[model samples]
Target: MIEYCLTVLGFVLAIVGRMDNLRGFVVLPKRWIVERFFAHLMRSRRLVRDFERSTTSAEAMIYWSMTMLMTRRLARQPPRRG
Candidate 1:
């Protein structure tokens, strides 16, 4: 009887632990999404042409340039040694 109860409790604990992992992995789009959107924008001709002819082009260029710089900086930073 004691062995059966311990087995049931272990099963319940396993189910709860898996549920926590599922919740932790689910995330909303944010920084990674914005960067990816611009990375795609760089490949697209529509925005490139529009930027070439419009006043907003400078702003778009600056924003994308800064974002790219930041991405590079983040990538090269050494991980904490501690």
Candidate 2:
């Protein structure tokens, strides 16, 4: 029983070591990403604001647009198999 426990603990530690490497590899550049995102937003700021205010309709259009955008994005992504 003691040897079985030791082997299982070592196996868990090995898997955890690889997880640490993956964590480092997955971290992205925060500053550059924020700057690029803001630049893109600024480019379309006027157009988006104008469209948002042009109609006196309810906010459903905005919500619908966001839902469709997210749905399309999710649909385009590949499925993850367990």
Candidate 3:
């Protein structure tokens, strides 16, 4: 049902499944990237709580948080010689 809704909204959903009979502490592909991004988002004070009254407002906060993260990463990189 959720997948159908997402498809209707033009979003492709990819489900990452766990390996069968896997050992303990196994890391799945692309999962860590999502986890790391959410960790970074949690660092923003505005995102720490559910203060937004609307979904749009919450999405805006996420965008703002990601922009800040990207800018900080860019600032730390050395300038490229042209």
Candidate 4:
């Protein structure tokens, strides 16, 4: 059931092409998204500084930061209606 819903959504998004600009070229939504995510991550003082020496730890901090940010957003927003 979820697969069917996801397949349908893929078709719908393909038609919409939200990633495209007026010239039919792919816009840099990913770059914008990454930049925005980092902006939020920087709100954490630990992330703002290069305190983590290990790459694994840095990546973990990023994941932890994103989790906190998402949970906070989810808490603020009402649940979706079907």
Provide the TM-score for each candidate, comma-separated. Answer: 0.32, 0.28, 0.76, 0.54
Clashing pairs in 3: none
Please give, for residues 1-82, the per-residue lDDT of candidate 4 as tens digits: 5566578765332222363435665547666776787799999889999999899999999899989998998889687899
Give the best candidate by TM-score.
3
What candidate 1 gets wrong by more than 4 Å, as runs, is: 1-51, 79-82
lDDT of 1 by residue, 11-78 (tens): 33211123354544553445457678676666544455554656687677757766766787788969
All-Cα superposition RMSD per candidate: 17.6, 16.1, 3.1, 10.2
Please tell me which model should have the higher lDDT, number 2 or number 3: 3
Candidate 1 lDDT score at position 13: 24
lDDT of each: 0.60, 0.52, 0.90, 0.78
Question: For residue 52, what is the lDDT in candidate 3?
Answer: 97
Question: What's the C-alpha lDDT at position 30 in model 2?
Answer: 58
Could you give me the TM-score of model 4 versus the true structure?
0.54
Residue 31 of model 1, lDDT score? 49
The TM-score of candidate 2 is 0.28
- Backbone clashes in candidate 3 total 0
What TM-score does candidate 1 get on C-alpha atoms? 0.32
Cα lDDT tens digits for candidate 3, 1-82 = 6688687886777777888898889877699998898899899999999999999999999999999989999889698899
Candidates 2 and 4, the one with greater lDDT: 4
